[model samples]
Target: MRKILFHLSLILLFSSCISNKRITYLQNLSDSTAIGLEEFIPFAKVDYKYILQPFDIVQIDFASSDPTLVEGFSFQRPMQQGMVGGGGGQGSDPLYMNGYSIDESGMVEIPRIGKVEIGGLTEEAAKNLVQEKINAYFKDDVYVRLRIAGIRYTTLGEFNRVGVQVIYKNRATIFDALANSGETSLLGKKNKMFLIRQYGEGTKIHQINLNDRALLGSPFYFIQPNDILYIEPMKIRQFGSADNLTASLALFGGVFASVLLIVNLVTGGI
Candidate 1:
């Protein structure tokens, strides 16, 4: 009896608390953590926000740059391993992780633009601004194509899935990733999520509340390139609470052993 109880306690103690993290309840979303209509929040503080960092990839096309509209803003994209393997043969197709790195001088060289400044420009702003610059040199048809070929974001928190997401869509929202990455549980404290943003040499941290309707207007609602969001878990979910579980097992073991001993004595011949 003692040996059995000892083994049971050992097994329970080592087991992980947050188990079965996958959202198998996708069939029963109502019973799941994602609930209530979320009040949307804008990306934090609308400063001339631009997520492009060194080694970022961008694609620019021309609606009509003259079959040879002066090469249409020439640029370059470097390839790398998908991180699945930093060594080689990462994939049969060899996934192309694309992006141009910002040179220490804080400029990106174009075949024509020639070392243009883009460190602090947002996707939309960068697109519009780049178009104007292109039009100046070309008088014919000049529709511009701008995209963040290697932009991404990192979501860290109570979520079942946590990782850095590479994006091609020049635009996306925070809620977008949260939903796609397996939404957080009801126990996830919505009001205190953290948004870690990098601006030049400094990084800014913002506290946000998912539960508050005011978030609809907050600038942080729209996720930016290279932004990292961390959603913290509630305090009660802390470790050591499992210790109480072991104590309960110990109590049950005592009662069972006492009862068995008493039964043995009563049935024995005097």
Candidate 2:
């Protein structure tokens, strides 16, 4: 009986040491304070302005009194005609077919407008620059709308669905990305989520704790194009507990052994 008790005590001690405290996010806030806030606090003080980069697709739409005359400025894809008795089919997305790509030289070649340097400029600034150029050609009130084709980001590490995700939106938050990718798995270390961002001539990495409300004020609250989000695996995952099956079996085995030892001691068999 003493031997069985000693083994059970050791099991409990080891289990306590392998706690999930590190995995929990935002441990500083009290449950009451976090849930009692009435008004929604703004996560970001200013709007996130995404800068243009090389290989980014830019879509420009023109609106004016005469739409037909300004059609030359917009991108158009040629419809595939039935050459061998097949009907004409729709082609790829208009944005990809006709959108302008920012070259390595930080310029986008517009039809009849020549190369315009838009790299390193925010989307709003790029739109204004393009609008100014369009005004020179058209005398009428030509409204110009410009935007990035999509916000592309990559997910790595312990995420359940890991790959490059292209979200079409003017603004996307980190939580949006996680939700879109089916949310993080149990093995994902939410406290160690890393956001890798690209800056001029270099890059910066920021660690985020998803469990903490303090992440709301973080600059990385809004994700940018080409950013990489990596969720590290929990430390416990290294010891063959990456999946529920393994953990369950281990737990069952421990309980079974404890039971066997107790029965053997009571029966005077071992």
Candidate 3:
């Protein structure tokens, strides 16, 4: 009877799949840090080349020692926040609506400056180019700051935390995505992960293997806007979904009743 009970308990434990085994596997392998465990990549320190994509909302702010000359422009675009280096002004209320939306022509209309084509320019180049445009109004030494408000990425499957994360730095690494999503479970496809990237025309799906050290240097390692990080479930979720524990419990109860009946019959034998 004890042996039978022990076997039944094992089945129940198996039904709690996708929780235990995956976590245990991940905890054993993953090391949490901004730095990678393998060889260094050039893109690691150097700023990544990023193109402004569609559906992205961006802000551009211009400030000078003399605020009087900047009266004609809208101060609503990129209000100084979350720049690469610290030491800007405090966070103030947005001066206008949520940044400028890229039109179908891939252009943003700035007051007094007209339309600027920014879809193909990297963030750094865009800042310099924008500063050139705004410099005409105020002093030549004016400051131009650019920021994006709608940058985001999503993570799903076999992860501890799975959801959309808003990106501030305009760059996110593979490790950053997983960590932000509560660290993926060990049972998840750690060695093999899927990344979905969205473009103006459509989307592209790329497969990455984390077990390989080259992954640290891969171009896909840096996540872009509208990117999806999906970690596929292991064999456990499949087996767990097939579990019919309720029926098994009923069968065990019925077996216990039958055992009681057989014992009573033998005791009553003449």
Indicate which candidate wins on TM-score.
2
Instruction: Let me know the TM-score candidate 1 reaches against the reference structure.
Output: 0.55
Over 1-270, each residue of candidate 1 has an lDDT whose tens digit, in order, gives 546656665665445333333222212133334434553424456765575666555655566636677454543445543453211233421223333345655565666766666656666766787688877877786787666654467777776556766544546666776775566654455667888988866789999766544554568767777788787765544532333535555665677568656755775634
Off by over 4 Å in 1: 1-48, 51-53, 70-101, 128-142, 167-171, 185-187, 235-270
RMSD per model, one decimal: 8.8, 6.7, 8.0
Candidate No. with top lDDT: 2
Residues 26-99, model 2: lDDT tens digits? 45455424633454646767555567888888887778898876777766567633321111122344455668
Candidate 1 residue-wise lDDT at 30: 35
Model 3, global lDDT: 0.63
Question: How displaced is residue 191 in candidate 1, in Å?
Answer: 3.3
Candidates in order, TM-scores: namely: 0.55, 0.75, 0.60
List the candidates ranked by lDDT, beginning with the highest. Answer: 2, 3, 1
Model 3 C-alpha lDDT per residue in residues 213-234, reported as the tens digit of each score? 5566568767787688887866
Candidate 2 lowest-lDDT run of ten: 82-91
